[model samples]
Target: MKQMTLKTTSDLSLAIAKDRFSRGTLWRFPARVPLLLLVTGLCLQMPAVWAQQQETPGKAAIPQESPFGTYGSFEKLLQAAQGGDADAQVKVSLCYGKGIGVTQDYEKAFTWAMKAAEQENAGGASIVAGCYLQGKGVEQNIPQAIEWVTKAANRGDVMAQYNLAATYYEGLYGIPKDEEKAFFWAEKAANQGDREAQCLLGVCYLTGKGVTKNLEKSAYWSQKASDQGAPAAQRNMGIFYAMGLGGLKKDVNKALELWKKAAEAGDSEAQYALGSCYAGDVEYYDPDKIYQNMPEAKKWLQKAADQGHERAKETLERLFHIKASS
Candidate 1:
C-alpha cells in the first residue's frame, strides 16, 4: 500500500551479482534457527519480464527476470523505490539482491532496505537484519544482526520473532540458552499464524521447556501447524493420533494418513514412522490392516534411511535384513 523511491542505475552487473551470491549466507540447521532461508520467494514477483532480456545500448542484456521475485518492470519498480513506500523499498531491495527485474547490487539493496527500516517497518527491519546476518551488502556482524533482528521481533515481525525464538531455544549464535525467551517469542509468532512458530510452540509445550508440559496444548498447536502443511507438526500430530494422546481417541488410520502426508512431504521422521509401522513394528493396535504388503513399508523406510535416520536404518537391517551397504 506504500510507494517507494530509489536512485536509478543503468548498471548491469552480473559479475557483481555473482560476487555477492558467492559470499551470500544461506544456512539450515536442525538444532538452530534457520535464518529465514526458506522464505526466499515470499515477496511478490514482477510480471514475466523474464521472457525477454532487456539490453542496454552499450551493456550486455541483464539476466532474465527471475521467477523468484520483483513486482513489475525495472523502470516502474525504480519509480516506486525512489518514492517512499516501506514495503516497496523492501521489494526493491529483494529485486537488487536477487537480480530479478534488474541487475544485482548488494550495496543498493542494503541502502534501500535500511531506508525502509529507518521508517520503523517491521519487514524492512527484518530484511536489514538478514542482510547483516548474511553479509549480503556489508561485513558480517553478528552483534549487529542480533540487534536488528531483536528490534524487528519487538515490533512483531513474525519471521524475526520465530528466528529469535529458535536462536534462544537452541543457544545459537553465541547467545545463551533461555527457554523463557524462546517460549515468549515463539508464542508471539504462533499467535500471528506462523506455522513454523506454531510447530515450535507445540514443541515447547510438549517438552515443558519454558512452561509446564501440557499435552492438550501441544496437540492443539501441532494440529494448527499441521493444517498449514508443516512437516514437523504433521509428524507430531500423527504420533498423537496413534497413541490417543492429548484427549484424542485412538485412531490408527488417522495416524497413518497424517504420516503418509508427512512422509510424502519428505519428513524423514514420518517416513520412518510409515516404514516401521508397515513393517509390522507397530506393532501398535490396528484394525485397518494397512500392512507392509502394500509395498509402502520398505519404500518409506528406505527413504528415511537415506536421510540417515538411525532407527530407520536399524529397522531395515533388523527386520528386512537389508544390508547397510545396499
Candidate 2:
C-alpha cells in the first residue's frame, strides 16, 4: 500500500496559531451548538405577553400575527416573547443576537434572553452565557459565561456540556487545563449522541490525549459521529478504512464508499481521495461503477482545491498542464 501525504489548511492554521501562542499556552475551544441545547427547553418556556414590545431602532410597528397564521415572522415571535412566552422569548433573542429579520443588537439580545434566564430557562441561561463569553452586547467575561454554562451543564444541557467540555479541553479563562475532566465531560456528551463531542472524543483516542491511544476507540467514536452526518467524522472514517486502522479491516471498497459520501458532503480530504479513486484503474473503478469519463477527477479535485487542499490543487495544476500540452 502506498502512503500518500496531503497538506491540509487546518494544519497551516494550527502551525501559525501555535507559533503565535508558543510562550503562552492558548487553549483550543471546540464549543458548538450541540453543547448548547441543554437549556433549550428553559429558553422556550417564557411567558408570551411581552411579544408586543418592539425594541429595534426605526423598525415598523409589526403586528403580533402576520396576515397569515403560522406564517413564521420574527415580529410575531417577539410579540409572543413580550407576552411571557418562553419559547417565543428564546426565538426572539436568537433573532436579535444573530440579526436575523431584524437589526443586530446584542444588548437587545441579552435583554430578551435575560428575561427567560431570570426564570431559570436552561436555553436562556446558555444563551446568556454565550453572550457574555463572546461579548455579544455584553463584556467578554469568561468567568461569568462559565458560571452560566456550568449551571446549564449540571442540568444536563447537552450544548452546555459540550461547551463546558470544550472550555475544559482548551483550559482558557482563569481555569486550569484538565484533559481528564475534558474527556469525562466529552464522553458524557458523546454518549448522549452529541456529534461534536463524539468527533472530539474520536480525535482524543486517535491522539492518545485524555485517553489511551486506541485506534479502535477512535474509529468507533468517529463512526458514531459520522453516522450522524458529521463531515469531519465521515472523512476520518474514510481515512481509517483506507489505512485499515482502528479495528477496521482494509476494505478499499468501503473506503471508496465512505470517501464518496464525505466528498459529496464538501470534505476536501474525501474529495481528493475520491478523485484518486476515479482516476485509477482499480477493480472497483470499472466504467460501470465509476463514471471515469465524466471528468470526475477534475470535479473532485477542483472541489478540494476550492477548500485549500494544497495537494489537490497541485495535482489539478499538473493534470491541467499535461492535458494542455497534449
Candidate 3:
C-alpha cells in the first residue's frame, strides 16, 4: 500500500506567506491543487458606511432622510463634518479620499479620518489603518497600520477581524506569523458571519493549524461560507465532496456543481478542477461516464494557466501538447 502523507495546513500557511512576500497581495491556488491558498485580505477595506454597519450592530437606524446621510454632496458633508459629527467626518473623509464629490486629497482624508478615529469610531480606525498600510496621506508605517486595525478588531469590527486574521496568518506587514492568533481572529470574524473568515477557519480545522483537525468542522464552516457565495469556500466544499473527506459522502455530481459555481466566479483553482474533470483525469469518476473534451479542458486550463498556475501550464504542455504562451 502506498503511504499517503496528509499535507498539513502549514503548507497552505507557508504558501500564503511566500505569496504575500512576493506579490504583496492575496494568495490564490491552482485548481485541484492539494494546497489551499488564503483569500486576499484586500476586501477588508469596506466603504465607510458599510464599515459602520458592521461595527455597530443594532444601533439607531442610520438616518436616510438627511442630506447629510452616510453619503451626500461634498459641501454639505464637509459642513456637517466640521460640526463634529463623527459619521459625517467619515463621509467627508471618504469624499476627499475617493474624490467622490471633491478633488482627491489624501492629507485631508487622513486628517478627518484621524479625527473620527480619535473618537474611537470603528470605521475611522479602519480608514486610518488603510491609509497607513498604503501610505496614502502619511508615510507608510506598518506597525501603526496594525495597531489601528487591532483597535478596530477589538471593537467588533468584522473587516478588521478578517484583516488581522490574514495578517497574522501570513505574518505580512512586518508582523510575526502566528497561527494561533490567526485562528483566534478568524474564528471571531467567522462567528460574526464574515464569509472570508469562515473559509479560513474551515481550512484551519481541516489541516489542524491552530485548531484540532476535524474534517466535520471543516465541512461545516466551509458550507456556511459557500452558501454565502464565497468562491474559495465553494472550491473547498467541492474538494471535500470529490474526495469524500470532511464527513461528506462521495458525490462527484455535487462536487462538479460546486466547482462550476466557483469557476464561474473566476476562481483559478476551480477552473483547473473543472478542466481536469472534463479531461477525465479526476479519480473516482466512472471511466465510461468520463467524457474527454480537449477543447473544454483547454479552455479552463488556459484560464488557470493565464493566472500563473504552474501545474496548469505544465499539464497543457506535457499532456495537451499545447504551449500556454501560445
Candidate with best lDDT: 3
How far is 93's C-alpha from truth in model 2 (Å)? 3.7
RMSD list, candidates in order: 14.8, 9.9, 8.1
User: After aligning candidate 1 to the native by TM-score, how far in Å is the CA of 222 from where it should be?
Assistant: 0.1
What are the clash counts of all predictions, listed in order? Answer: 14, 30, 1
User: What's the candidate order when arranged by decreasing lDDT?
Assistant: 3, 1, 2
In model 1, what is the error at residue 81, expressed in angstroms?
3.2
> On residues 107-221, what C-alpha lDDT tens digit does candidate 3 reach at each position?
8888998898898877678778888877878887878888988887887777788778877877766679799999999899889887777888987887787888888998899
Error of 1 at 16 (Å): 35
- The true-versus-predicted C-alpha distance at residue 174 of model 1, in Å, is 1.2
For residue 238, what is the lDDT in candidate 2?
Answer: 71
Q: Any runs in candidate 3 off by more than 4 Å, and if so which?
A: 1-23, 26-72, 288-290
Off by over 4 Å in 1: 1-72, 287-294
Which candidate, 1 or 2, would have the higher TM-score against the true structure?
A: 1
lDDT per residue as tens, model 1, 73-133: 6566567768887766776776777666677888787788788889887766776776777
lDDT of 2 by residue, 1-326 (tens): 23344332122111111222233422211122222222222222111111111111112223444321252676776787888976567556766765667887778888887787777776677777767766777877878877887776776666566666666766656678678877887898788777767877887777766888787888899898888776667777776765567888866667778888878876677788778666662323435445554288778877878877776776666664422111
Q: What C-alpha lDDT does candidate 2 achieve relative to the native structure?
A: 0.61
